[model samples]
Target: MNQLQNQVSPYLLQHKDNPVHWLPWGNEALDLAIRLDKPIILSIGYAACHWCHVMEHESFENQQVADLMNEHFVCIKVDREERPDIDHIYMDALHQMGVSGGWPLNVFLMPDQKPFYGGTYFPKSNWLQLLNSIQSAFQNHKDELQQSADGFAANLEDKSIGLYPVELNELTPIIPEVLAKISKYLDPIFGGIQKAPKFPLPSLTLFIESFPEKLDTNFDVYIHSERQLEKMAQGGIYDQVGGGFSRYSVDSEWFCPHFEKMLYDNAQLVYVYSKAFQRTSNPLFEEVVNSTIHFLNRELRDSSGLYFASLDADSEGIEGQFYVWEFEELNSIIPYEKHAPFYQAFQIKRNGNWEENKNILFKNHSVLNVVYEKELQTLATVRAKRIRPQTDTKLLLAWNAMLGSGLVQASKGLNNHKFLENAIALEESMIGFWDIKNNLLLHQISYSNQPIYAFLDDYGSYGLFLIHLYNETAKVIYLEKLRKIVNGVYQNHDQMNYLFSFQSNLNAALISNKYEITDSVIPASNSMLCELFFWSGILLNDVTYTLRAKDMLAAVLEQAAANPLYHANWLRVYSEWMENPQALVKYNPSNYAKNELPQLRVTWVPIVDQSHAFLLCIGDRCLSPCESIDELLNQYNSI
Candidate 1:
């Protein structure tokens, strides 16, 4: 009687055998809770989330705990990825309750699905205590909780409705100032935007693409940003031993990382570094880019071609156990002659780098100055033997799309065919497995043969990826696929004005649902959809997509134009359209001469269909696509 057997989310299926009569988040679960007059215990998590798995194994699977849950409460399970709207609402409630929200989020809701209390995780004893207390409150103080639920629901509905205004045209002009504020938020010493426990800031990185023109020649802001990036690249947050980056740094100095390796972070960072390489021609940026891609190829990618989601932050139930090492271990690995200088330079004391006896990682910035010295190579060789952390092998569509775009960027900037080849391979993998039919992409693919339907973000992101890759490779297959997916998204989600809604057909089954619009780590799907439409129109030489793109852009134009600084996504679209509002088609990537000319601002639409592999040069007067890569190079050289 495992209710989750019919569910698609792997996270939900992990609790299938629990004695608790777990219901998937739907109208049925809400209706049951209302009918039974019981509090709803809603648990939210994703499959790749380690803590989510840990909580599942510890409590959700325990028969006694399950029995308690089944008898006293109506338990429900939700996958955060499958339905971000539900997760967002509950997470907001948790935040409002003054708790920092995280995966394995457990919320106590009234029969009406209004969350009254939520905490990330609790041990068995604490969980039991809370459950007992909650049951008591629900039974004895029922009217108070009911009143609170009513209030909560009204406030939540109002919040969701207020998030997306009907007219946003007034806000676009101020985008520059908000973007500057974002830049100001960057830690000059450390790499990330904020303080400790920093996220990779992929959203910010994408936003950086629009700022080069605004920056000065010395690019002080740009230099500061690059310096922060370099600090991070050299720091332990980036796997110095491995090629990929971890989830984020625990401390602001980028000294200690959480140790989880995410495919999305690396992919996005790679794209950022590649652009940095092109912008500055910095050798350090190039090295980081190469090393990152090396890590992606070596560990994260599956044989079938799609990239995995993330590596766990902890292994064998001990956080940082796999990645950390003792000083003796490093000493044993290093030769006698090289040990002293290496140890001193890295701040490696006899005790250790992190928790006294255990080594985290340390990099001497001075090493860059002396990297050519003979001692450096010998030290690097010895340091490679430590045990690395395990990787999460779940392939995610959104992540793969990010990687695809990264490869295209790397290829464009580095002129590396290998990068292009890897991009193609990964894209092929996504198309092969996630394409479902000729129309849609799936969200996740696991080894257990379970195929989950993609969410709004996945489809939007994947579509963006296809378009970017087509721009790079100009492969017909990619463009055609891009066309299909874009049209598919419009078919699947568009109600009227082309403002993309996150809720899909599957979400209609939910008893009480709400629409929301706050771009989380990634930009909103509708924002991405608009960008895709603009680029698609320019690349395909189609006016219909262009008109749609105009409407989409106009929809947000006023807000974006008025306050474009805060709206990074809108600024990015503006950057693309800046050259010629009407003559966007004149900036096609397939034009060889036009494509090769560096120093000109570059914006590419994904060209999927196999068009001529030449570069199109957009000058003051004419248009002709160069026939060959060398020809394009020759034109740039002449210029």
Candidate 2:
């Protein structure tokens, strides 16, 4: 074992026994690079990435390749989940280098940590050739390489420097046009954008569902939402036996998945499907929501109620080994009487849909008619005997917060008290990490019980979770906690207009301060913060939070205008900003069931307060106080 044996990150630990001397990204590695005047081979990936595993086996574990890497460069490995701040910096560098970014990110940087060349996975021979070439270039042409690195670093810094200030007036008129452009990519049949690899772009779907008024008359957002939800639920990307969704589908049909389950993805998905269930009263959506929550509670949850980061795709060193099954194996496991229905329901074929006669179970027929719970249980029981995939046990604050918030939303939509109970438990557990004196949260609790400083996403999502809890329970303490977190986040920023992805003190080793604007697999932290600001402003009647939200939206208006889908979360914030008559309803706790408010079905009604009477407000204007639920509903409808 090397230096990585001392690290807490699961991804780093996976490489602890590798021949390559892998150092975790920190001052030691950086200092070594500087002292030796050696270029750095920085590799970034997560535990769940299949290609990352493949690359590790192909080149990193190979003795010849390890010797070359050790002799020529200072090699650093980063777990993207644990250190997304580092990933963002280098991924942005790769994009700036005009390369499309993906997992197993291999970038060769100068001793100063400026990336001059990079690419994704390469075969062993190619990797060896590239290493030799890079070493040669560093030795023979130092000046040219330094000039290129300097130019790249300068360009990267430039992206963060200038901003064209946008006013609220300029943002309103562009909404309709932005929505129209976004709709052009929507797949009428399969529901996501017409693309080969389909992701359940939750923010995009949420934005589409949130603002139906902005969509063209020809486009029905519900149809798109329903189709997408149904397809994903029936797809192999979803664990039909187990609950929760895989990362993304490799094919447009959603039948082939990458097979890693992430906390953030499932959390966002739970929110998405729950909203769909509420809007359409679809049983399928309700089932997906329930099963997903079950999966989280069963598979991902720690004893303290915090969710783990992810479940790896590969088990026993083979991709999809744990998930797929052979036709003969299934027949032998399941009884003869139940075999036909089971095979037919899951689209299990003798020929197999995946590699080496192994099938990835998907609903080829109508999902509505199928009820294979017994069969699924049988399969699950049998599969449990096999070696399970490695679970990345680190508890991430932002991801757990997302899941907690999602549980609250799901509970409301499904009217399931158990979900709400789980949410409350999760919230309680997450609160333990809060440093009340410092007014900040720890980013994650490692398996070894080490605490890392919180990043922007941790503050944004956790703060939002607190706000959600406040709305649900009408507890003033959560609101107070949110206020402190908000204050702490703003204290680090030079300007309150936009928040950076990493906190100021936490980002000492980063090449540049990054403001994450575009939504990737999860919603952007800046966008989540904008949502937090808008809601908190109205709930607390604070103008500063509201005004700052508008300014932050304005700051990203140009980017939102350019690629609205990439900035889908920003559009959700913009939609909330533009669409007014946001009903802030206050009611007496004695008059109604505080926990079970059917009125929450209305997404616009964000704030709920317990008082002697019910009052509805739209921005400063207030309706006359009502005494009962009926009167409150009538007043809300009239506006």
Candidate 3:
């Protein structure tokens, strides 16, 4: 029987039938281990992780492993996604233990539920040996094991939970300084930040774009940002042969990719690229955004407009197999007439662009840039014929909401009606389909299917998305949905005095009493929640939500004040809060329904209640209800 018989997470349910009598992490499991005086074996992984699947098949499925686990220790299974707080605590433990960590994280905890030993996946033979060795140590060196566990527990307790804040004034000047410093770090001959194994730092690129707004309008800053953006747009990091970006390049020149593609990266990159196009009027940047959109539509997005998580780095048991091309293969596939144009567009050479005569994808002597419109169209058609990698179809709520927000932003920036439409459709899917009758979000939805219950981050992000979608379309329904969800989140998750936990039920896994501000694969749930309260207050004319927003910020203000640069998300929130807030309220939803508004250069913030009064410095501006839609629009735009 699997350890996850009655568990909530689908990932945990997958291991229920494994030979190991794996116990889900809980009080009962911990209590049993404590009573038996046995070490706890905690195995952590996610549902879609490929290597996690491999380890299960190789070692966890074995009867010998199960027998050893049952007899020698308490075995526990943890789904990293379902319980990130638990994952964070253990990951920190592994770091302190001087061991590298990855999924499935194999950690041996003491009876008290503190990790004393851990490593990632080990071969089945090696794993069996390890089990025997650990069993021996606990039996023969019981005192030694107790001492180590006690020391580890003490060290963990000593680690501080206090937050530090970075000052906004200090950050106001640092953007230019960082831009200059970053310009020096850029590979001049090739585009990208520094040397090989180039991860696309979309954040850095966007920072460079915003540098001028934060600093002096020096031409150097302008020119440097443009050059960096242009070079990367044309290079292999951009998927010159295909249409979308790989995760990163293995080299500084944006050549030789790591080859995985993530929906979050593409969504953020599209917003950045589209904005760059607007700022510089660079056709190449425009092309990059357009191609990336095509890639998302073709592979990433479900029918509802929510995007899937990722495409694997490997295909057919080999890394980059689906993406890499050979000279002979290219020649064999293309006719003589089209071959020259194709070669020029992709920067292909007879010697090949990568190691061992394979094209890692970069232009050489022939292709200066993808200058012609016809050329790009032709390449897109040809590239579509190639074998594509399988995509991970699990629809994560936070990520989907992020893509929804990004697509809506991009649509506004590019004046693309389809992108806006896609955003609306996605919002409907999340609100109408994913929400269980229990008034909570489902975290993962199958591709082209209905969603499951949502995570803490889901409601927070979706709430924010609803607000943004309202800004885009000026639909009352969007705002109304946002209000309902925000109220639901506050009532369901909030504790007294500005605290919120991840789980709706107090009996569910205890995540945290305080906010976690760290930006990981997704922006922090706490940060998004803070934003929802702040904005909802402005749009609705409610003071309670606004005050609650301040309380949440104040709770962590000290931490953010101490480390402003590292707390980018907090700083972003602070910047808006401190600035003269501009509120745009349109009463006539119909006017905005068909109109294509020029993209606002400012970060468009949609606030409802009385929160806008303080930010806009328009105290009690309009107490009387406006008689007409035009009057409301005018009053809203005045701020």
TM-score of 3: 0.77
lDDT of each: 0.67, 0.81, 0.65
Tens digits of per-residue lDDT for model 2, 330-431: 888885466687678778888898889999989865465237777788888988888999999888989999898899889878988888889888888986
lDDT tens string, model 3, 461-494? 7888787787766567887777777766766664
lDDT-superior candidate, 1 or 2: 2
Best by lDDT: 2
Model 1, 1-639: lDDT tens per residue? 458877755567767877778988766788899899999999998755767767877887788888878888999988776567678678877877789989889999998788788899788888888988999999999999878777666666422332333333333444445556666677766655667777666555556643544443434456555766778777778766555787778788778887778777888888888988887788877888998898888777788877766776766666776667687776676653565766665566678778858876567672452453354454445544435445555667777888888898899788798898888777777755454554455666652333445666777778888877765655677767777777667666634444665555533433233333344456666667777776676666676876676566665555554443345565566555543232212333445444453443434433334365544444222245655556655654564
Measured against the true structure, the TM-scores of the candidates, in listed sequence, are 0.82, 0.94, 0.77
The candidate with the higher lDDT, 1 or 3, is 1
Best candidate according to TM-score? 2
Whole-model lDDT for model 2 versus the true structure? 0.81
Model 1's C-alpha root-mean-square deviation from the true structure amounts to 5.0
User: What is the TM-score (0 to 1) of candidate 1?
Assistant: 0.82
